[model samples]
Target chain A: MKKILNNPSDFVDESLRGIVLAHSDMLRSVGDPRVIVRSDAPVRGKVAIATGGGYGHLPVFLGYVGQGLADGACVGNVFSSPSADAMLTVTKSIDGGAGVLYLYGNYFGDKMNFDLAAEMARDEGIQVETVRVTDDVASAPAEQMSKRRGVAGVFFVYKIAGACAESGASLEEVKRLAEEVVINVRTMGIGFSPCTIPASGKPTFEIADNEVEIGIGIHGEPGISRQETAPAKELVSQLLAHLTADLDLVPGDEVSILVNGTGSTPLEELYVAYKEAHSWLSQKGIKIFKPFVGEYATSLEMAGFSISVLKLDETMKALLQAPVNTPFIKQL
Target chain B: MKKILNNPSDFVDESLRGIVLAHSDMLRSVGDPRVIVRSDAPVRGKVAIATGGGYGHLPVFLGYVGQGLADGACVGNVFSSPSADAMLTVTKSIDGGAGVLYLYGNYFGDKMNFDLAAEMARDEGIQVETVRVTDDVASAPAEQMSKRRGVAGVFFVYKIAGACAESGASLEEVKRLAEEVVINVRTMGIGFSPCTIPASGKPTFEIADNEVEIGIGIHGEPGISRQETAPAKELVSQLLAHLTADLDLVPGDEVSILVNGTGSTPLEELYVAYKEAHSWLSQKGIKIFKPFVGEYATSLEMAGFSISVLKLDETMKALLQAPVNTPFIKQL
Candidate 1:
């Protein structure tokens, strides 16, 4: 129940206010304060990529909006989907002359809201396309992959799609490229601690001190099972096993691994996990390309990390290396 | 301890191994494995900035070694100073024809070890200068500022000194610039929870569930006092009061604020604090330049944050804006 916030109801608005105030040069707010866009948004002839979801998972939902990233982001409350109105506002503000593309994680509430917003935007003579990131391999069986939830693997979607869109690609091209990334991405995570939502002032879920939840969802969703804690080497191997198998990865495969901290995990710990992952992949003869080891997505102060792998091609590798200047991430 | 690590003794070494593995293009380990240097170290005549301290605080000690930052760093165990031999190795590997500047926080163990290393390097015919960072306003009184512990304010030291040295400044000149930053910087922190060291599966410190410690140190050292958890506004106000007064900040002064998370504090919470600090400074007519609000330094998984204010001048402002490309940071 401990948090460094003032009024619970004002958490999202105040945080956004602070974000705009601090990063005024790179980002701005539209008529609806909940809709944030890059300062130079609506780049003429460039397909705009819009993303959004609940707050808390920073550098994810809103933190990715900037030059070389998403053109705009719709802000939502903690662990809650943004309103369709907010998404529509974002679509209207950042849609360059070309078209707008909706790129976000696959969650029922977010999908429903973005779909409604897309329908409304199309009614107003605007072209829109949707590409939901469903990369969490642990969320569903391979046959029911569509039911999987999006996780940190969404970083690849943003990197590839944002670069492709920035290249003046049409909406169809951008959507297809993003879909290709989603098809190649896979992620699995574990949770050791839970975070409390300000409004509720209650831990999202309870976990035993000596146990860890494998394949845990970002929102504290039930995973495969709770088991006694194990070394990072073992946990990383378990996650990568699910990821590599789901991707049908084999020797001679090339991939980009993102050792993402869910929240409270230390950066040093992520590197430790990365070391294990690198060793694991090396043993399997999988060449890692441009590995990202940090927090790309989070669940408030949840204490855990996830391992995400993005199978890469020459085109994806080239785009992934493109310069990106977001407030939270700088791949320059 | 609930850490994502293998053998506790191998934490620091394994993390550094992973770091070098991932950032091979930007950094490399000298003969001593514990001593890491920029991939392009000994930049002909550029003065090298050598920095190091204990582990755990990512982006602080070793994370600063890259282009436009520290030229080398010596690794140490968690919350423990590194050996003098490692520092000597770093100094020997990175010292160019100009000289070497040994810059690190003002801690008893670090000061002792670096002093010994500087002596050895001097005996080896390498020019050496030292400037210990003392920026934690909460650690000591203004009159005894030399005894204060360095905290996240070290970021300014690395930035200004690294930029100055990068410009081919002499060792003495870099030391002077770093000393100037130390004089202008002031920081204070608060903690809500404690983190356990992997070596000893016990909490570093403890407080009542609903209480918070003000003026807390990165090592879980005793702070001012514990009190009921207050909103970030009141807490930030309390921190800035000490920071501004210690610096004798005038209404027209310009400064850069670093809202630093000790470890587990969420980025959203840091921004909320930044909002309050920005408003507070604005009301006093003090202009903020280059505000950094994130995890510049951390204390394992302790849930707390610190506010560091650096009174800036034209020279420092220009230098601070210079491009920096480190493994943990990129200001390009």
Candidate 2:
């Protein structure tokens, strides 16, 4: 597999090293270089929000750190969770007197490490809370929503929580709002191609050129089934069927829509999908309040996309529209 | 070739349809659906800036149409220029009485069409001036710089022109400053893979899996040559060598850097390249201001990137730092 890299093993750190260098005005490394924090971290009395996961997903954990977003992020090796020690270091670096809130996707490795880090932080007398986002409808049955994997929908949680924390909300309020965001969000993806893990130098999975895996996870996990590639309209319709069913959205319900590219998918294609989504929702009489289309969360060079819908109340809608500035997602 | 589209011929129009629906808050179409303009266009007494070329490069022409960027964009088919009639309609929609400055990449087809559009707009009593960006260093020799093709460096032109227009600079001043930006900019790109033209259902060019094309154009034009794939560091070094020589950047000079990803290149990979560029420039004692590393301009799904350096004087630096808001590129 062809890629732009130095040492495959050093890919994550080198990328982070470059991130800190390229965005020194907004981000910096603290304690450990793997732990990136806002340049102006630990703002007095402001609740600190943090997220962490495996690397390779640009603009996810790290790119989302800035004013009105996460104050800190713990970066891990490609497709591997950060060590608890690394997470603890990041938590300590950004913990203001108020408390720290950890917002991360629901994954076994991440859960184990983040849990241990939370315990260590508690022992050190820093108040901490956690919200594990489980929004991927394809990963579990509707009745077992908590067992679902988190995908691009976690972006909504980050935006809502970051905005709530920036408003000087207490750690509990921010956590509660973030949890609510996770509960109301639903995401489902389809993959046209698999991505290569740097160390492995091979695609995580295989797909025929004219076939696609519907209901695919971000990590290139086996999807619902492999089928002949369909047009953008059909793909969007299929994904929407699962997402809308999971959310049980009623007519007149307002929501924020995110059509996120999985690494290699072009914005042009994402917009094509967005067009169908807009018409689909409108036909159902579902009111779309805000729409975002691009690569927000990704599996490195995966050729596909995920559609995420965050059902919005007045508070959620306001927070979604709130001004937040980050390297990847910025609103003013 | 697999793509997320319906009819191959409908790719551009369907994609534009999606863009208007997804970004309804910021952009809309007027007269011809292919002509996309800001929601608040024709602001009286303010110089309007419009740019367009082919449609495959999503964020290039359309993405830059917003606050502090181009006021309107005339979209065309994939890898092809918009018709002169479409450009004239877009020019008319955003004219605002002050004038309309058409800024776009230098390509034979685009030049012919945009030139014809400028004539049409002038006939209709609209003050129209055109600046075709010639910034891709590989496209022509230094002595024949006027014949160079425009690539990612047009982004610098848009920012400068948009900022100048937002400051209420007259059409002539905006054109002068925009031309100055073109003069100070240089860009070079290498491609790891060829992009497909939708209607053809085949890649526009071919390179062995283990080979790479250096000095490639956005539309898959033949590059300097194809050779064995090189690591990110070496590739950046090779590109920087050519760009620095062309710009004659001296020590202590200030420059804004853009490590732009061609569509499918991952941001993580881009950062890896940016890391090398940062160190390389710092070694030369160049003061980098406003380093941007992402997909600002792209070929539909090309897997590569171009590095752009804009030697910044005080005015250029200030304008580059000015606030701009759009669906793709937003800075505050």
Candidate 3:
């Protein structure tokens, strides 16, 4: 593989060390190096927020640990679940007197690990709540929504939950808010290429030169279809059609938009996709709130992007607009 | 090409339009859509800062325009220079009474286009100055410093100049400080893959599966050499060695570090690089300040990243720390 890595097996540990060193002001290592906590974590009387999954998706689990966002994160190897012990370590470190909330994308390994951690935390006398983000409409049919995978839309849940927790919300309130964010969100992705896992020293999947996979998952999971590549406008329309219809969005509905690049897609290409989404939403009489266009939730070096639409209320808007200062994201 | 684009020839325009539409709160189009300006531009007495180049690099020209950064930017087609007319339009719109500073990476096409724009602006009775960023140590030998190409190190110049201008520095002071930043900064890049320009619909360059090129320019210009891919630690060491030697960095020196991904490179990879850089600098007894790791400047979807070091002083540190809020970056 043409990846810049040290010992393939040590990729996650070394990268975690690098993250702590570079963002010393905002993050620090907890009991385990895989568990990262805010430098000033355990905010008294505040609901502590945490997330984890894999390491390839940077700025997802770790980058969100800062003011007005997640307080701790359990890091795993690239596309692998973090050890439950690592999650418990982070949970113990970040939990204040109030409680702790575990939020992450809906995936089998993540669900099992984080759930195990939650149970362990409870046994340790820490109040724990769990909410999984399931926003990828193409991951499952409408009847099997619970089986859908979470992708870029997870960022919306993190923002809302982090803001709610920062506001001194109770564990129940934070959990409910996170779930609400997940309920109103819909996401879909298109893949132009596959990313290699450093450890495996090969691509997770193979993609053709003249084709694209619509609604692909971050880890190279099959999407709805693989067809000849379409223009940005058509792709955006198709993705949005699936999402808007799935969400039952209607005229005059207001929503926030996020055009998140999987990895290798440039911001320019994302903006092109957003341009078309904006026009489509406008035509539907739907008001677009703070439209975000960038690489938010990414697959390591994957070439493509995802679109997430969150039907927003005044409270959701306020929560998302709250100030945040983190290594990957900053808003003021 | 497997890119999400429509009418390859219209890529830049559509992308720029998308940017403006999504970032309406922070950016707006001037006379020409190719020219994007701060929504609150021409800050009466603040020295206007502007940069322009090909459109592929996001958060470089347009993304940095905001309260304490650039005031406007002239955008061009992918990997191509903005027209003289576009630059003139942006320059006129952002010129506060204090004058305008044209700062951008030193490239033949950008220099000629911006120079022409400066002349036109002067004809219209607006004071303007140009500071070419030449920080890439790999592009040229020490004796041919002027021939060096600017890479990711241009970010240091932008942060310093923007802060200086925000502090109400006089036109000469801003220009002088900007040039000072240029003098102290050094950058080098390693490319694992080439980025395809939309207009061409083909890769700018080609590389073998297991080879990497060091000291590559953002536009896929040739680098020092193509060698078998090395470990992240080794690559970081080689890159830092070139930059530190060129900067004449000593044991007692303090510097700011930027580990920037050139697009396609994941944050995990960047942090891994930073981990090595931190250890190397610490062993040298060099103090690191405000170390940044992420995709700050990119070359579309090119893989690999760049390392930049700016030997810093108290003034430069303070300037870099000043508060700035924009769509892409926010600091407080």
Write candidate 3's Cα lDDT for A218-293 as tens digits.
Answer: 8989999999999998999999999899999999999999999998999889989999999999999899988888
Q: Candidate 1's residue-wise lDDT over A1-332, tens digit each?
A: 56778998998888888889989998999988789999998899999999999999998888899777899998789999999999999999998879999999999999999999999999998899999999988789989988999999999999999999988888999999999999999999999999888889889999889999999999999899899999989998999998999999999999999999988999989999999999999999999988988889999899999999999999999999898888797564
TM-score of chain B of 3: 0.98
**Cα lDDT tens digits for candidate 2, A103-181:** 9999999999999999999999999999999999988898998899889999999888998999999999999999899
- Comparing 2 and 3 by DockQ, which wins? 3
**Which wins on DockQ, candidate 1 or candidate 2?**
2
DockQ of each: 0.71, 0.74, 0.79
Model 3 agreement with the true structure over B229-332: per-residue lDDT tens digits? 99988998999888899999999999999999999998898899999999999999899988988878998999989999999999999988888878886463
Ten residues in a row with the worst lDDT in model 2 chain B?
B323-332
TM-scores of all predicted structures? 0.99, 0.99, 0.98
Q: Per-model TM-score of chain A alone?
A: 0.99, 0.98, 0.98
Compared with the true structure, what per-residue lDDT tens digits does model 2 show for residues B89-150? Answer: 89899999999999999898989998999999999999999898998999889999889999
Off by over 4 Å in 1: none
Extract clashing residue pairs from model 1: none
Cα lDDT, model 1, residue B300? 86
Candidate 1, Cα interface RMSD: 1.3
RMSD list, candidates in order: 0.9, 1.0, 1.1
Deviation from native of the Cα of residue A46 in model 2, angstroms: 1.2
